[model samples]
Target: MEALGTTSLGERSPWQDLPSELLGLVLQRVPSHAGRVRLRAVCRPWRDGARLQPPLPPLLPLLLQRDGTFLSLPDGTVHRIPVPDGVSCLMSTGTGSMLFLGHGDGRCSLLNPFCRDTTTPQYVDADCFGFQIPSGDPIVHNVRKVVIMSDHIITIQKTFEGYNCALSIRRRGQSTTTVDVRWMPHVAAYSFDAELFQEKLHIILSTHVGTIDLYVMDLIKDDNVSLQCILSTPVDNLFLPFGHIVDRYLVSSGDQLLLVKQDICKLYNKLMSAQFEVFEATDLSNGHAQWRKVDTLMGRALFLSAGCSMSLPASDRYAGAREDCIYFLCELGCYGIRKENLSFGIYDLRKGTLLSLPSETMVAQQGPQIASWLFPSNT
Candidate 1:
């Protein structure tokens, strides 16, 4: 009996006889989503194998800006996807959606550009939220940062009086409750950055006196949510002279919380350099916590920006991703003297090396725009 596809020469394509198990393995190793899509189009057998394979984790976070343009880092490709109409300013971004603030009317809404879903418009009075409209400031000015979680929205704003950190909680079939953290002592001179972890809120504040403080607050229905101080450490003398110019970020990875500190120094008019340090929460059992300096992330990669911070494994399957490395999209210009220049790069923890994105891959923009690391949803 003759075997399948066996002719006089006894030659056949190896891919034609590839087993399903091996095909599945190949599909799993395909790093980029575009590659996976192309693999499915190769042939019927490969398509079937692709369908059987599990969803692949994101290789690199996409850089999304307020202008409805995004750059995919894997291939340095830029694509434009318009946001909802009347969205003049981008406020925050979440799982698969973005929060937008209107131009002159203080209108706010949530938009999922990929899904084309826009929530009902809600009027927002920035003054009521502790933001003063300085004589000629932009409508959405003075907002340092914003974070949107499952059931809450947090904002850090600078007002005429001082800095204000507000948390707005929303629940199904209930009116939203707004809570302020102004009651916390020594908050006036500091700017805050917050992240939601394990159903609670973790915040890090950088004070004018070159001190860093960490606070944990519980989410409650009432207005009196308790805020507890977790850690307070004075920054080194190098940062003491800069005061509030230093940047601090709080990120939660697995069961631990990480504090990333970036110290910026001005070299000249527009040139600047930065150094980074990472600390991890070592003791959090039984409601007690302590922070310790961490040298590495143990094969994990961190993505950080103004919106939020995320951590994922730096698997060997994904090229260009290194363990104990951080991919940051933040500003790195001279503090208080000139406008911040938005930058992106990878910071290696093991080698203490800072690698900037290739110039050709960066968007040609003159001013700072809303940029963050976005994980594309499979759906």
Candidate 2:
């Protein structure tokens, strides 16, 4: 023990000679998070391993920032990412890639973190409509936005100031490849894109009669981009089942989609209906659509809402309790939750077995944004 602190005999510390992996393992096992941060500053080997950015792993947890910052947070630290300037819209499609919307020009950029590359889809021509064929045909799909629909790809419908709107799909992996799939002429007047299932891409349409219609595209076409609305359960006044639930209760964990819905049964007791769903990346290639409610999630409540709000930092600075979590201001107040849990939760989706977090500690907020790392483990 004295040898670690000894300086007289001119003896070198044995830890200096340890393998890189061993040092990393030792660092990982440290209990105090602050200690780990200090250790990284002690040597070059430690710093590299701690801050390495490998290929974006499948199902990697992500945090969507309001100020055009979309990040892959593993331990509660922020890896500053350079995004396209003037991007006003951002959505994490849960595919280690983000769908971004830019201002000035209504252009779409599909960014893949794993590949560290960007695909700028072709621009939409005014007064015309186009769609992409999944058959290696590439067209810049400049609909309202772009979404990966299971085996198919769907773009939001777009409209020009003086022209009609259309949809298009750009081929994958090749530059300048695009195919248009406009299945029906003037179908439903207009349609908005949404993630229906973990893998299934859907279109939400409003008919002339004011009835909202939902059409689930058939993924089995030669072009692999076709639509057939899901029948039996027609769209009604309660057209927004998911939106309504999110307005009340929903929380998303890393790859776990939580929904907490409130219902009044019998004569008047409000019951919280919680559904826990997990999205597995393997399912995308195996025909297992987007998200599936994991039956085991059925249980009790974890958190009760005062209210929830989406908060962003005034500047580019980002901080959080743990690497996987971030601190941002909401209308309700400041709180902590893993960054990946932002999308689906009790407040966003009325579902999931409730359980209190392990600890409740005070964290500082910086101009409506709270930036900090998680407390290290106790072991």
Which candidate has the highest lDDT of all?
1
Which stretch of 10 consecutive residues in model 1 shows the poorest summed lDDT? 170-179
lDDT of 2 by residue, 79-127 (tens): 4456566443344432323443433234445565433567544543322
User: How many pairs of residues in model 2 come into backbone collision?
Assistant: 67
**What are the RMSDs of all candidates, in order?**
6.3, 12.0
lDDT of 1 at 203: 79
Residues 1-379, candidate 1: write the lDDT tens digits.
1243344578654665567788777766666655666676666656666677665544665677544477766677676666555444554453324544534444445555555666534545543233333554443355555556555555666554555444433332223323334443455445567776777778787766666777887756644567787777776753345422466788877777898876555433222255678999766555667678898987788877776567877764654366888877665531232243555577788888887653324654333345666665551
Global lDDT for candidate 2?
0.35
Candidate 2 lDDT trough over 10 residues, lowest sum? 370-379
Pairs that collide in candidate 1 are none
> Top model by TM-score, which number?
1
Q: What's each prediction's clash count?
A: 0, 67
In candidate 1 the C-alpha lDDT for residue 362 amounts to: 62
